[model samples]
Target: MPALASHRKPRSRTRTNSPAVGLTTAAIASVSLLSAQSATADPKPSIDEVQKKVDDLYRQAGSATQEYNRAKESTAKQRRTVDRILDDVAKRTDSLNESRRALGSYAAAQYRTGAVTPTAALLFADSPQAYFEQSQLMDRLTEQQRSTITEFEAEQAAAAKQRAQATKSLESLTASQQSLRTSKQTVQTKLAEARELLSQLTAEEKARLAELERKREEEARRKAEARAKAEAEAEAERQRQEREQQEQSGSGTGAGSDTGSGTGTGTGTAGGAYAAKAEKVLSFARAQIGKPYVWGATGPSSFDCSGLTQAAWKAAGVDLPRTTWDQVKAGQSVATADLLPGDLVFFYDDISHVGIYIGDGKMIHAPKPGANVREESIYYMPIYGSIRPA
Candidate 1:
């Protein structure tokens, strides 16, 4: 019976496509290969590495930001200068036109009177004898001719001077425009590179990095507070010693005491009465706390390091230079030991960063992008120098 059943036609089996079989094999192989590759892939960067990389990028961006700020400042200055020059040029052009009209009128009048001939060619020649003859002949000239010649000569000279001035100004404007373009390109390039570096990280890495930055800033704040406390204590001690010395020697002089300028920093009386100008500057800076740090922004809202300092001083009626390079040279240099509130403290070997000294060891600064204006320890970074602006 089994042999007979086997011999009978078996139910037709459902046919599988040969291509489907091959596809299944290929998919399996592809997945396996991918798995192997992933298993052997290089490990991701450690948090430390990522942190360092982010820090480096931030520093680079900071440098670039300063460059951008300087460029923007330069551009703004040049624009104002250009505007002034253009305005002068326009006025000069009008003057020239007026001169042309005046000359034209003189010529038309001369034509009506049967144009004056050589009249005094030899007299006007550039020779001593001609000069003498011209002086003698001047008495024979009509008042009308003399006035027309004098007006024409004066206008010609003025027109010539204006043309020369306009040319020089045009040249200066061209140079400034070139500088602006260069600065803009440099800013764009640095920002783009920074963005690219930041993009290399995964979302998790970025989150961790941000957390790290927050912790660092927190540490800085704590250190600033501690420093401020220590400075206060030191100042109190100094005053006590000064009083003792005065009592011991019976001297009228208060040794070890500050000038009481209210600008004295480190433990000496900060928050004292800063100069009215300096008070305004400090007020402006304080009001700007929490504003974002934008590279080239000199703002009612955002600012770079130098921009913050510059704007603050400007509000105080002082025109500080636009960049750290120039700002560093703005006023008298003060030793770090003698730094005062409202003083401009510069950082880095390149003098790229700046902040306003707020007494003790704290300073108000626009730290960097992703950070808002905040008071931090001046010693958070290596300080290059300090300057007194007011």
Candidate 2:
């Protein structure tokens, strides 16, 4: 098996037709050998070819690792399936054995009775055919006892065979998994070694690399911000449309309500409620724009949908759980339109997504992949319901 390392040179002009999992380790080792060959003053491959080979090995190694994991899971599951079935058979056989013993005791009692009344039974045997029938009946009863024993033994034998096969299969899968893992580790090791060997670069090279990375990050941030701005504008328009028609004649003091009356109309904080806390929550939530959305992230920087909600609530003298699944069940139930700005909105049936309701049919969410924290029309995603912190 080839040893894999993270830093390895490329293998060019070679066709190793390697198993996806084991190939990486071998590739890494090969690269190491190739580097040594270079030290021997052998003609070096073109730079482009070398880079391409390294890239190919990296891609191949990733795919092989994934494949190996999937295969190991499948085989292990299969072994478990077979083992469960055989266990069920063994339990049945055990029950049958107890019944067989009871039947044997009954047969013995009958045999004792027949022996005690042998003369009477002989006298009652009125004809040759009747006697012969009695004898055959006794033989048949004995055969039935033998048949029960044979059946029990057969079932046990079958169970044993199945168990052995399952064990063998499990062992095989375990061995294969270990082999793949070892090969992957070997390749990663070799690659890392090679990369270290070739890591000596001029200060200019390092500076240029840093500059390129910075530019890439700048471009990515610009794109994300543009997307956020567009979404926020669309959300503002949607909020206007949704609340415009729902204004009461005497506009309620709800902050989400439009102040469209000849008098005063605006969002209202709950009376005798945590006013300062709610305000802090609203601020913290709105401030977290363009934060990277990582699944299950709850941090000073990155966040997921539920993570944002939990953190925002925590800032406001409230506590929420860390995951969407847990946050859904963390609060009191409120009517569909009864949610406040700090209320949590659940999305999808499985409760895997959550966002804070911003009132007026608007919500702020991390959204899907590639989208950062941004305000959006609630209708953009499936709305499961709302939650109020307990």
Best candidate, lDDT = 1
Candidate 1 lDDT at 119 equals 24
Query: Which 10 residues in a row give candidate 1 its minimum summed lDDT?
Result: 114-123
Model 2 deviation from the true structure expressed as Cα RMSD, one decimal place: 19.7
lDDT by residue (208-301, candidate 1, tens digit) is: 8889878877776787677677667766766777788788988857565444545243434433444666778889999999999887788988
Instruction: For residue 359, give model 1's deviation from the true position in Å.
Output: 2.6
lDDT of 1 at 253: 74
* lDDT (Cα atoms) of all candidates against the true structure: 0.73, 0.59
lDDT of 2 by residue, 1-390 (tens): 997876867767865675885879889999999898888985644444444444444333333333343444555666676677667667866865674454445344455665445434533455323443565544554665545545655665666776677677667767666765764575465455445423543566546545654665466456545544554565566557556645644553463543221110122324325444556777898899888765435667877676688789898878876556667788877665455566788866656567776655557777543358987656554568877684
TM-score of each: 0.70, 0.37
Prediction 1 TM-score vs. true? 0.70
